[model samples]
Target chain A: MKKFTCIVCPISCSLAVQAEGGGDITVTGSKCDRGKAYAKDEYLAPKRVITTTVKIDGADIALLPVIGTAPVPKELLRTCLRHLYGIKVTAPVRMGDVIERDILGSGVDIVAARSAVIKKG
Target chain B: MREITADIAVVGGGPAGMSAALRACGLGAKTVLIERDAALGGILNQCVHDGFGLLRFKKQMSGSQYAQQFADAVYESSASVMTETTVLKLIPGECGSKAQSRQGLYTTGEKTGGALIRAGAVILAMGCRERPRQQAGIVGSRPAGVLTAGAVQKYINVEGYLPGRKAVILGSGDIGLIMARRMTLEGIDVAGVYEIMPSPGGLRRNVAQCLDDYDIPLRLSSTVTEVHGKKRVEGVTVADVDAARHPIPGTEVFVPCDLLVLSVGLIPENELSRDAGIEMDPVTGGPVLDNFMMASVPGFFAAGNVSAVFDLVDYVSDTGEAAAEGACRFLGGEALPEYVTVRAGDDVSFVLPGKIRRDLPSSALYMRVKRTIENAVLEILADGKPVYEKKHPIVTPPEMVTARFHESAGSGVPDAGGLTVRILGD
Candidate 1:
């Protein structure tokens, strides 16, 4: 039995997961199906989406905020951030522009969180 | 000074200001949004983290992305926006057909010169600011590395600079938890988070994802007693606190760190409101507002963090929309009705819209708890008679509870008696 807090929503349901010999997983205290799915995934192998920034050139700001398009393996968050920190993109980066594809082979693309146009001369 | 005329003048271009300006424009009123920052997104520009706009968009979005949704709409709308503009003063209840004598705002813009913005209604949307170390009451030498979590966020996410390689965060609030994760991801060693209260100040989700997931330590019932640095922060002395939150004598521990981040609390920026002599709420530290988000002064409104510091940006935007709607109503020459006072009762910190008009068909009241409790019932009472009740499995001080009341519900809400929101717990 494992206790987990569901972060799927603001409700923050505390889910109790029970499994015996991996036969079947029973999740309790989740208000919605999304929380159930989150509990199962968290129980099997925890994962999280990385949200951070990367260096950008020719933009008004020095850094361009980015987010992983999907959640990746939780353990690889540090490695993914290391990859993002080294990478730099130019201005004209649009929202959803892929900064890095298949980051750390996690199959999640790092996309720009916001658009940054060229700096005014 | 130059003069600009509009139906509505919105100060601050954050989520609330943008939403208010957009909503006001949608109602066919000429709206002008004035922002102190260079960009229209305001604080959201530096808040690069995800998990925003969950309620409104039904999906987790980065703060910047969430702000962009409204920013894009504002740009497409007819509402005029003035970035890098500072509103010096608000002269409420003074505007009319005449340009010079109109109730208006005195503002100065970096690109555009100082101007008198005459408007039929003014919506104050300036958001809250973080409490610094001095305000947090840490006896320390003035050091360069001590900064608020928001400032560090801007430094890392916007300026691409790391203030320090090692840090100690004070306060277990959401921002502190998020910054702990952020700094850890940026290769900074966070010694641990020291919180004065026994319980975490932020949401449980943040504790689960930001700290627990990252293997960071959350030390409760502890606080930074003293700072030990001169030019730059060298270290801090932390101590465990007793029930009264005073530091225990023998429980002091020295932790070496380059930066000390303060996430103690947020106070609504109400200088303009105070200067205008608006009735203020001693608890919320904002304005005494009515159901329409209208301030004590007629034709003057307060919204978003300027009214109360909200946990979610969604609620902030909601207040902004309400203020805009109220401003539009004021412009339409709606007559003011008798108001019923709304009071905070037992176990509640504060409630927005300090008062509500007696004849209002419906109104939403946002509130927070004084402490955490499970199996509690949130009850709304009118003149000591129960009007509405909701059973909650749990309630925390950090989480806000929103209760909406409709006069047509036949809930026996009186027009003369005041409304009191309280929590019934064992």
Candidate 2:
């Protein structure tokens, strides 16, 4: 049995999950179906969207904000961010432009959150 | 001085101000919104993190994305917007007079010293500001690297500069917790988060996602006693505090760090409210409001953080709409009925709309608890009789609670002496 708070909503419902050896799991204390689904996935394989900034060269701004196009495995967030920190892209980047595809082989693309235009020298 | 006239003037172009301006214009009022910044989103532009607009939009979105939704609406509406404009002063009209006589002193470019804006009504939504290090009373010399959490956030998210390589956060507020995760993602070392309260000041989800997920240590009942540095922040002294929040002697431990980020708290920005001669609530640190969101002066109204700090932006928008409706009613020349005082009882901190107009169709009392409690029952009493009650699994100070009352509920009592809200442990 494991206990945790469901982050699916602001209610923060307290959840308790009990799993049998045969992969059977029962989640209790969830207020909504979303919480139940979140708890089940959290017990099985947790995933989260990682948002951060990446360096951009020859742009009006020094950095561009980016986010994972899809939720990646929870444990791989740090590795993904480390890879992103070391990389830099030059502008004419648009929102949703993929800076890195299949980041860390997690099958998630890191995309720009906003457009950054090249600065005229 | 140049003179401009409008039916409604909204100060501050943040989410609250934009929503209020839109609502007023939708009600057929000639509205103008003044924003001090070049853009309209205000602080939301710098807040790029996700988890906003869940309540209003029913979908999770980033702060800037949520703000853009409102900003787009404001742009499409009939309301006129003045960017890069500052309101120097608010001059109230005759006390208890109608809504059309008030005037605001404003300035646009540097060359234009000042201009006068005469409006039927004014809605103040300037929002709150971060409590700086000096207000926290930490014994230390002034240093460069010492900055507030909001400043660090703006620098990293907007300016795109890493403020420091290593940092120690002084308070465990939501901003500090979020910054802990942000700095960690940027490969900055977070020494630890020291909070003076027994429990975390931020939301539970923030504690879990921002601090616990990143392996950042959260030390409750602890605080930074002193700062150590001559030029830049070299370190900070952490110590545990006693029940009275005084630092216990001989428990100081020095931790080395390059930056000291203060997330102490927020104070409602109410300079215009004060200058307008509106009555203030000392406990909430904002103007005293009525059920219609009107200040003591009839034509002046306030909402959002300019009235009081709110936990969620959804509530801020709600208040904005309410203030707009109130302004419309005042402009329509509707007579106000008798007002009943709303008081805070045991275990409750304070309540917004200190008074309620008996003629209102319905009124909602927003309040916070003094402390965390479990298995509690919240009750609203009128003339020592319970008028409303609701059971809660748990309640915390960080989360605001709202209770609604209709005029029909008080039909029997001709003149309810007072209404009080209390939280009782089960």
Task: Give me candidate 1's interface root-mean-square deviation.
Answer: 1.5
lDDT of 1 at B17: 95
Model 2 error, position B198 (Å): 1.0
Model 1 per-residue lDDT tens digits across residues A1-121:
9988788866789899999675789999999999999999999888887899898999977888899998898789878888787998999888889999999789999999988889999
Q: Count of backbone clashes for each model?
A: 4, 0
Error of 2 at B254 (Å): 1.4
Docking outcome class, model 2? acceptable
- Segments of candidate 1 deviating more than 4 angstroms: A10-13, A16-19, A22-34, B95-101
Query: In candidate 1, which residue pairs get closer than 3 Å at backbone N, Cα or C atoms, i.e. clash?
Result: B94-B102, B94-B103, B95-B102, B95-B103
- DockQ for the candidates, in order: 0.72, 0.40
Candidate 2 lDDT tens digits, B1-426: 787788888999998899899999999999989888866877877777787777788866667666767887898999988887888888877422445746554556453346777888889889999998878777658877888999999999888788998999988888888899988877789999999999988888898888877789999999998888898888888999999999999999999998999988899999888987889999888899998899998778888888888888888888999999999888888888778888899999999988988778788789999998888898888777888788887789888888787757753442567788899997
lDDT of 2 by residue, A1-121 (tens): 9877788765788899999788799999998899999989988898888787788989876677777777899889888888988989999887678999999889999887666678977
Q: Looking at candidate 1, what is the lDDT of residue B381?
A: 84
Query: Tens-digit lDDT track for model 1 on B1-426?
Result: 898989899999999999999999999999899998888887889888888898888888999998877888999999999988999999876656553235679999779789999988899999999987778997646978899999988888888788999999999988889899999888899999999999999998999888987789999999999888889999999999999999999999999999999999999999998998898898998999998999988888988988998999999999999999998888888787888888899999888988998787889999989998888898888877887888887889989988897766636656567888999897
